[model samples]
Target: MTDITDAAKRLLLGKPMSSERLGHTLLPKRLALPIFASDALSSVAYAPDEILLTLALAGVAGTIWTPWVGLAVVLVLVVVVASYRQNVHAYPSGGGDYEVVTENLGKNAGLAVASALLVDYVLTVAVSISSASQYVASVFPALRGSEVIVAISVVVFLTFMNLRGVKESGKAFAIPVYMFMGAIGLMAMFGFFQYLTGSLGEAESAGFVLTTSEAYDQGLVGLGGALLFARAFASGCAALTGVEAISNGVPSFKRPKSRNAATTLLMLGTISASMLTVILLLAMETGVKYAENPAEQLRTVSGGAIPDDYVQHPVISQLAEVIFSGAPWLFMLVSAVTGLILMLAANTAFNGFPILGSILARDGYLPRQMHTRGDRLAFSNGIMTLATGAIVLIWVFDAQVTKLIQLYIVGVFISFTLSQLGMVRHWTGKLRKASDPRERSSMRRSRVINVIGFLLTGTVLIVVLITKFTHGAWITLLIMALLFLLMRSIRKHYDSVIEELALGDDLAAARALPSRVHAIVLVSRIHKPTMRAVSYARATRPSVLEAVTVGVDENEIATLQAEWQKMDVPVPLRVLNSPFREITRPVLSYVRSVRRQSPRDLVVVYVPEYVVGHWWEQLLHNQSAIRLKSRLLFTPGVVVSSVPWQLSSSQGHGVETTYFPQSGQPPAMEDRKR
Candidate 1:
């Protein structure tokens, strides 16, 4: 069974590589761009839709400001990218936001950043994959209602690919990512070229009139409009979700890791900014209309409602239809790659989350298992964990990107604001110690950039919380707060355990020998297993030894005594009465009595257990012995030892018998011979 499972694993993940091969897995700049920047770049596919959707509430008058909102988003993206470049250079250990905040702001502040980033990474996968499924469904209308299933399937696929190793996944994803870039770049250039030549046509949704909601009938005129614009801006800032991934993944790059990572960050910011600008510009120019409910929010010029079956395509799809109308194949190609890139964007989170989880685990905030590398040298446990989280969110949200977007960006901005604030502190501390003139000037410049970054991101964070809190952002904040408390509790536990296990000047006293050793063998009947336990107890050469059992029935006790006399057992047997047929409590009471009789004695309880081969056989045997062993383990100065008698069915399963010493020293050679 084990061999079959291992074969399946090898088929899926390939053979295990040696730890020395880790360096060989380092990504080059070309590969790292796609691996770490896909999320930020793919935001182009959905960020514009979110911006337009939020504005559609105020009707067409509000939608005209889409370009300005996108530019605002781009500005924040630029500052965040620049700020994180400093982070990667200064803290190349790949701690990213959590490390920066922890070192500069303190542990509690750092934990806050960690909690936010962790929640953000999960949402990144959920939102990205869910949007990708939308694109897929748009192209294949038959799959429209099954987006949740499709998104989950894609997540599973990506998880397995990542488990194969980071570099391997990077190589596989590089082509599709570059193809997406080319497709979008070509579409943008074609759209602009057609616009310059006075040949670009309006989108299919252009003829429809967007009706304003009653709350915004005045349209971009007062306090309500201002709040709506801020909401739009906050929604557009989804473009910045994946910027910190580059900083979190610095160690994955080749030699000169920090420089490569920073370069990638610059490239990501440029490409994402350019893509977002072009998409939004073309969306507005071509008169693309997207709404939360198109059937209700859209109307004809005569003030009549549109058809109930009308499907409001995403902004990019509408733009593609208008820009690439002449070349149907080009439109399909763009749509396919857009979907592919959105799905691949989750790769950024997959790369970032595991590394950050490992850092948290190393710091004793998460389970220690999260810190270990798997067979493929990936944080396989963290990858699986992130996938599970994303899957749950996808299932619960029904893969609705619009609803999920309301919950997005809040956590990223929290991390962003705190990270930039930490960078400011980091550079300030550096400036005080730097006496060199050139270094001081550089530190001062970096400080200025981070300060601006902090201001912009902090404002955006506030806007996000205010505009989105009632719209689903509160769910994210609640999760982050819960995670923060959970991590703090875990750290406290780890610290308490460390304090308890710390050896002091009384080490010799802790290791002092007991005055006497008392051995007890638990028996059910005079069988080979019981005799084996008795023989092992006698070999221990304790000061006192006895065989004990629970007498549930008088007839059974009499039969056991007859068999014991027939076998001429050397050890005296004592039976404890149990009117209720309770096995564990009586054994525990007897062990305590023995300990009370000799206060300074060590009691070793030898339990006879049946070793079975198949899993089902376990349910049929060793039921009483298992319960008694668990109870005996907590008694003071008591040791529970198991003497296994392998059944006939257990043979040919590679099972072996070995002796283990309870003491801290190796057993004598004579014991080994026995």
Candidate 2:
């Protein structure tokens, strides 16, 4: 069963990649763009809708702020992208925010950034997959309420693709990303032309009168109203969610790594901002309206409430329908590309999470398995972890993009603020050391840009916290705090182990030798394995040698004793009685007594174990031998060795066999000849 499972996994995930081939997987800029930028680019799909939905809580009257909110998000996106371009250029080691914060702010601050980025990566998958499922549901109404299941399945599919390798995933994602850009870009262009010509028609929701719920029925009137406007802006900042991914993936780029990474970051910023602005503009031109509770808040021209089953589609879907008005196929194409890009957007997290995780692992903050590349030279462990987290979040939130979005940008902005602060410090330090005039000017210029970025993102971070805390962002902060404590504890553990094992002043401890050697061979019966272990242990020429076996049955012990005498074995056969029919305990007791008798001597326990070819055959024998060795290992002044005798069933298998000098053969062969 184990073998089959392993084989199936290999077939699904492909064969393991060798360490030498990692360099071969480096991504060119075109492919790198999609792998690292898809998350940011795809956020355009939902960011505008988020802005409109939040504003619509005050009825259609409050929805006029959509353009201004999108502008604020776009401005912030540009500064962040510019700031991270410097990051990719300066610290192209793929540590991203963690390395920058650590180098400038200190270890604790760096861990804070690391925790935030880790959380962001997880939320990226959850939000992107959930949003993608929403688009899928928009296209196929039959799958409407099954959003959580669909989101989880897509996460699994993306996880499988990423496990295949970075380069492979990038290739697969590039087409949809570009297609999405072309489709949306053309739709935006056409929608704008029609708006300019005064020929554009109103959206389907243009006629519906939105009545603000009782909670906000007064509509944009005081300090409470002002905070509501700011909250909408904060939510719209979801457009900036993936700007840091390029910095985290700098090392994955091909030749001129830093430059390619910086260029990619620039492209990501431009494309995402463009798409976001266009979508919001088109939604306005098409008069697209949304409501928090469509069944209640939405009313027809005659003032009747819409049915509970009325499905309110997203802003982009509504715009696509108007832009491709007569061409149904093109509308379907728009939806397909939107859904495809959103699903693949999780690929950005797949790329960034593993690289950052590998860096964290190297620093001893996470498990070492995260540091190793998988069969395809990707961080498979980290990929699986991100997928698992996303699956849980999708299930919990029931695949609602709005709920996930509240938790999404908090970590990302936290990272953005810290990373920008680090860059400011980085530039200031460089400025202090520079003697050349041109270099000094460059440093000062970079410092100014970083300072602007720090201020913008820091404000956004505060806004996100104050505006979104009660709405689910607090959960993200709590998880980050817990992760911070856990990482610090792991670092403390690794540090303590290093300090204890340093061996700085004690050379004698390293060269200590045993005063004497006492070797014992463990046996179940006078079989080939037992004889082989006895032969191998005797070759060591210890001060003492004995063959020990537990007598679980008297008749078997008698037969073994008779055969031992008949064979005239060179060593003494000492049988121990197991009153409880226990194998490991009695042997442990005997070894401890021997050590008690001779404190300075080393007792080497040789355990005879069978080697089998097939997985099922492993259970047929030597199960007790494995347990005996494990217990013996912790005993003071003891060494345990396994002497494996290959059974005839092992032929043609790849389990390595080493022939020890003159280990015994099965005595049954000699008996048969007699």
Candidate number of the best TM-score? 1
In lDDT terms, which candidate is top?
A: 1
**Pairs clashing in candidate 2?**
16-375, 17-375
**Cα deviation of 67 in candidate 1 (Å)?**
0.9
Candidate 2 — which residues are off by over 4 angstroms? 1-11, 14-17, 613-620, 647-650, 655-674
Model 2 local distance difference test score: 0.86
TM-score of 2: 0.94
Q: Please state the error at residue 64 of candidate 1 in Å.
A: 1.2
lDDT of 1 by residue, 1-674 (tens): 65677899999999999999999899999999999999999999999999999999999999988988998999898888888888999999899999999999999999999999999999999999999998998889999899999999999999999999999999999999999999999998999999999999999899899999998999988999999999999999999989989888988999899999999999999999999999999988898888888888889889899987888877888888889998888888888899999999999999999999999999999999999999999999999999999999999999999899999999999889999999999999898899999999999999999999999999999999999999999999999999999999999999999998888779898798999988888888877777767767777678888888899999999999888878888788899999999888898998999889888999988888887878899999999888887778788889988887778877756446654434323333443454
Compute the lDDT of residue 391 as modeled in candidate 1.
100
- As a TM-score, model 1 comes out at 0.96
Our tally of clashes for model 2 stands at 2
